[model samples]
Target: MNDLETRQLRYFVAVAEELHFGRAAERLGMAQPPLSRAIRDLERQLGVVLLRRTTREVTLTPAGEVLLRDARTALDAISAAGRRARHAGEPTPRLRLALKPDIDGGLLPRILDAYAGQEAALPVDLVLGRFGEQAQAVRDGRADAALLLAPFDDHGLDSEPLVTEPFLIALAATDPLAARPSLRLADLAGLSLPDGSSADQGPASGWHDRAGAHDDAATASIAQDASDLPEIFRRVELGSVVCFFPASLTRRYPRPELAYRPVDDLAPATLAVAWPQTSRSTAVAAFVLAATTVAAATQPQKRETPQTAVT
Candidate 1:
């Protein structure tokens, strides 16, 4: 309704997410009675039953489910608007870009240099995040653009592909498979892989998407969880788990104990520049153009299919 306030939506979202009035109240830094009254009043004004409650528990009605989804989008948009307004008011507003370290396919420096020469370029602000965080940062207006890998969630964003490189399987050098010239995806069917869903893992870990082996039951059963690249390398060296990584990683993080071999049938990883679909900033446009141009000049036009090379 036009009469609905952002505060009411915020209150509703907290309760809907927590599913407990007391917990939501505590989260919102308020007491239970007033929170309960506010929800009741909101339902009356909307002429809809949003929640179903009992002494034992709380649940969302069908309408409430729909509201919860839409409410989050609305709240994010409101927050973005406020952020943008404040940023615009600054005397020298910088263009915020989000990315994960070592995931840009080694094109970041060139891209930055290229953008610096653009007429509309502004000072770039780098916002580094872990895996699965760049897209949301763009969506919520925290960053103007991002450099991300492919096979990521691209909803509510527009992106341009920069470079695509084949995948390599990282395993203990002592493992039998490491001696092979090249391995097929089927060779890893029964091996344990890293769980990308681990909170500590970032996209740069090389196994964030699990690529071609995601559907394999054995691969799905996580062998170990790691927080950073060195930890992942340690697990691989110890034969705790095998991982799929973009070919670029071999050059960046070559290790003596770990061997990298190409997977013949595995899918390749693409690096792209992404920004909010609704973005109109000239700085964002210039940055995207600069990134794509630098990629075209510096990256190979066609990557050779995986062969027996091991690093």
Candidate 2:
């Protein structure tokens, strides 16, 4: 059997992710013909049709989807290997922590301070990411670890629990639903949810993962996409879409037109720290320990059973 090369996997991943040959070729800084040829050759080598290429669009077949996920893991591992080698030669290396801004319930600064106070603590570099981008930051070797909302896809990552808090539904103040003191997932069944930043195209698997993890609730289709949080809020205020947010976010970004209601049925959103499975740095381990320690210490003493780490 012929083994696939890293270059081939890289090409396939690029094309699979973009689902557009021309754009993928542009991203790879290569001509379109060779890119197409490489994908064809890869398909022959694998003895499976990886993509369904039409004149109008490029879509992944089931096999192609599986390959894309596996290929991404392989590419991330290769990149991580190179990054670790480069960092090994550096005299003083820092740990990069990626997170979405303003979602940590003010626990970020405390965790950083606690970690910095630890012995042999490495300097921490903060990498702020847009919604649904933190996992990629760690996978692509840009971040050593990520603080993410949970029920996230943990395919190639190790995650530890940090905090758990109830969620709130964000809706327009003028909407009749806002008059309720609290609600459940079923309450917003048919109302569309703001998918994500327009850059991401739609409500990513992360949203679905969080929403559908342990529930039997009906989901809403993507009614709108916003480029940023403000745009999402404006859309909500305009009564076009709705969204679910961590309870902490409501305290941080209060708006006159935005009303938040306690969501009683959905599982509490769990904030977790995740690192790539390929990460073998002691610094990253130390940081994870520091974060878990601080998180555990901050929670009330009455809670005895600790949250298990997600492998």
Candidate 3:
């Protein structure tokens, strides 16, 4: 079979995502008949029935599902290449760094200052995203590097550990557990915690023991729904749900009604600077060096064992 063209992959992705030729064509700003014909041609060329079309609806076959996933990654890489090339062509290129705001373990300002002082450093642009988006932004070239927590999806990325801090549980001051000096993961088995399915929660937000045992029953008992930290804190303030966060958050977001207690048995959260494995930019290297330097100088005791790469 011939290699698939980018245009064909784009067309297939639109159709597969929408599962409707008319809608997909509309989305692609094209006519429906040509879109349908193109899909048919694609299927014929591949000799695979990618989609099952009934009178009422369309659904992807197993092969279609696989192609959809791979096609998205391919398209993202192509787009990233274009973006990087344009940035490189600029007369005064800048480095874009992605991170969640106020979630950098109190090291962002120092890192930025240190980077700015470097002779090779470029002007850094901040691309703030919600939790769990930093790695993706780095992977897709939206940013040159990202400050992200560990236990994240590290595929195709190289990361260096910056700071590691204990995880703490946030609870309402009125709650009985708030009075405890410290708590353990098993202590939260029956209490309501923030829903992990929410996108704005980080990878460390999941309620699991130090040995990595997931408490299914506790997860099932989670009743509060929160999208962001403020919402989670609001729920905690209302005694609706308890939440866990890295210890840095306590200093960044202290609340009168919420009490943050150490979770003795939970895994410590490690903040790392991650960049794409294929990156060869001097600015990125300089930024990483600055980040590590600042982290070590500012929080030497909190620095975890140096990690050369993540996955």
Worst 10 residues of 1 by lDDT: 196-205
Instruction: Quote the lDDT for 153 in model 3.
Output: 76
Residue pairs in candidate 1 whose N, alpha carbon or C atoms collide under 3 angstroms: 131-203
The C-alpha local distance difference test score for the whole of candidate 1 amounts to: 0.81
183-302 per-residue lDDT for model 2 (tens digits): 766676567665432211222323433322212223223321332577778888998877777888888889999998887666787889999886777888888988999999888989
Model 2 residue 91 lDDT score: 89
| Off by more than 4 A, model 3 | 11-41, 49-69, 190-228, 298-311
Candidate 1 per-residue lDDT over residues 1-311, each given as its tens digit? 55889999999999998898987898799999999999999999989999999999999999999999888888888888888888888899999998877788988899999999999999999988655678777877888899988867786789999999987888899999999988886677567656633222323434564432333345444422332667778888998778777788788998889899887766678889999888899999999999999999976569779899789
Top lDDT model: 1
lDDT of 1 at 123: 99
In candidate 1, residue 22 scores what lDDT? 85
Model 3, span 214-268: residue lDDT tens: 2343543442123356777888899877777788878888889999998776778
Better of 1 and 2 by TM-score: 2
Clashing pairs for predicted structure model 3, backbone only: none
TM-score on alpha carbons, each prediction: 0.76, 0.78, 0.74
